[model samples]
Target: SGRVDPVTAARIGKVLGVDALILSTLTTLNVAEVGGISVGPLTVKGVKAEVIITGRVVDATTAEIKDSFEARGEEIEASIKVSDLQGLSFGTTAFNKSVVGKCIREAVENFARNIISNPDRLMTHQIELRGKVVKIVGSKLIVDIGSRSGVRERMTGKLIRMVEVEELQQYVSVPIGEVQVYSVNPDTCILEVLWAEEAPMEGDYVDLISLK
Candidate 1:
């Protein structure tokens, strides 16, 4: 019903459990007749249509615009009588088959191609999964992040141990090992330790690896 602001779009994206929201605007649209051409007994003109769209990728958690792009498409219908376009209107079957429709469809396809070709920035970078280790039993560890945080079985994370840095006068995380999710619940998940330099203990942290 109305244009959504970036913050609202981000809020909606979060509610939908999506990493990003795509915001698109119609930057330009034009339809006009080009010069006419003669073919035997008839003089026909070309009707040209152009469509341009501007797209933005908004990060769901941060409400930040991560990327922006522009896509354009054009189509020309040759040998067409100007009288035949009198009733053309958007969303009608006649309009959809016209030059403008094809131009819009092509513009959308270009937008999809742009996003797919640059997946590292638009898709892979949006995941943020990290939580503290709550419990440990035998070879398994329970982590605070679960299905609610987009956790799934087989997901892996690197375990981090808090080590005190005497010189820095602070505690810092050291990568101790890795663990893979074995099962998931609403607010927690069970993980099987993959490998570790030292045994991971409770209160350690884990950072989920982003899927490629």
Candidate 2:
């Protein structure tokens, strides 16, 4: 199960009730000895472990690959014995402390950072949701939307404040700022304001902008 095909991804998505899925495969894992190399005043020889991973974001409903990325990790141990790398099983404490395990961890970390930095790349379609700013503390804004409303972490929204037009005698919804959800609950979600023209207040409206 190193690779998740489109059909398998779709089936898993349906069972998990998710709109999208991220599939990753370990493309390469290698351990090589670096022959003695000059390092300033001394020659250095070491064992190097390298790992390469490929990742994809698939639209569960359409079974389409929306985005793809690659990450790599490498670790080198100077003046080390190759025997130390042998007989190491996956997930063991000793293995985790080994160079190979560290390489894998770094690769996964790189993958996560890549996804977090490019959120729009994961969007297969748009969804509309509206909620209210129920509370505020410092720069944190609490919204009414929650997991029950299909809300998840990392979702972003625009805060709208109503302005009364003196001449028109009507209230208009004006976008004041933006916020990204960081925490979620069954009936509520907490957001950190990204920016604001005016400080957000309770009773303001929220227009959902991004899906988690």
Candidate 3:
């Protein structure tokens, strides 16, 4: 096969002064008869062809796999042709080829759409956080948000309390106390009490309100 070799692809990228090159490989191709047609009087039927394609993409600069994708498509019914008078001898070879080409194009388009929709694949950030209390001693509540969630020393958050109503049977969160993030780890953090009229305890709900 005259597929683009890695060395050739790299050389082309360098010549073009490009940062990256996309290389794809056809891994699988499947063709099958799917739909059927009906004939009058004798009640005979015919079939259509469908095609599927799967492939992988690689980056030429680093020779790393960027992504892989798959797609499927069916042939156009009007394109099918018959050769013999007998309904049993139907020709769908052209339809099969068209479907295969369509599937390949559709697969590539779908892959690009997914990448555009999820631009966070390359970078990640901590926007908001929710926490639960695992332990409580006096007025301090130990929360489950750690260093991985961007928590650091001297960070200040708020303590909220959810009060259950017997009439409405709903829980309402009320602001109870202000606390400071004193210490943090990969899995947990300790909160120091700043000012609270009522002390919070274990199993209390904690939320990261804002940085102070």
Best by TM-score: 2
TM-score of each: 0.55, 0.58, 0.38
Please report the TM-score between candidate 1 and the true structure. 0.55
Q: Best lDDT goes to which candidate?
A: 2
Candidate 2 vs. true structure, TM-score: 0.58
How do the candidates rank by lDDT, highest first? 2, 1, 3
lDDT by residue (89-207, candidate 1, tens digit) is: 98888888888888999999998898888875566353658989998988889899888888889988799999999999999989989889999999999999899999888999998
Q: Across residues 175-197, which tens digit of lDDT does each residue of candidate 2 receive?
A: 99987888989998888888999
Cα lDDT tens digits, model 3, 111-153, are: 5665567543322222556677789976567899888887777
Candidate 1's displacement at residue 113, Å, is 2.0
Poorest 10 consecutive residues by lDDT, candidate 1? 119-128
The model with the greater lDDT, 1 or 3, is 1
Candidate 1 stretches with Cα past 4 Å from truth are: 36-44, 81-83, 124-212
In model 2, the Cα lDDT at residue 75 comes to 85
Instruction: After the best TM-score superposition of candidate 3, give how far the Cα of residue 119 lies from its true spot, in angstroms.
Output: 26
What TM-score does structure 3 among the candidates reach? 0.38
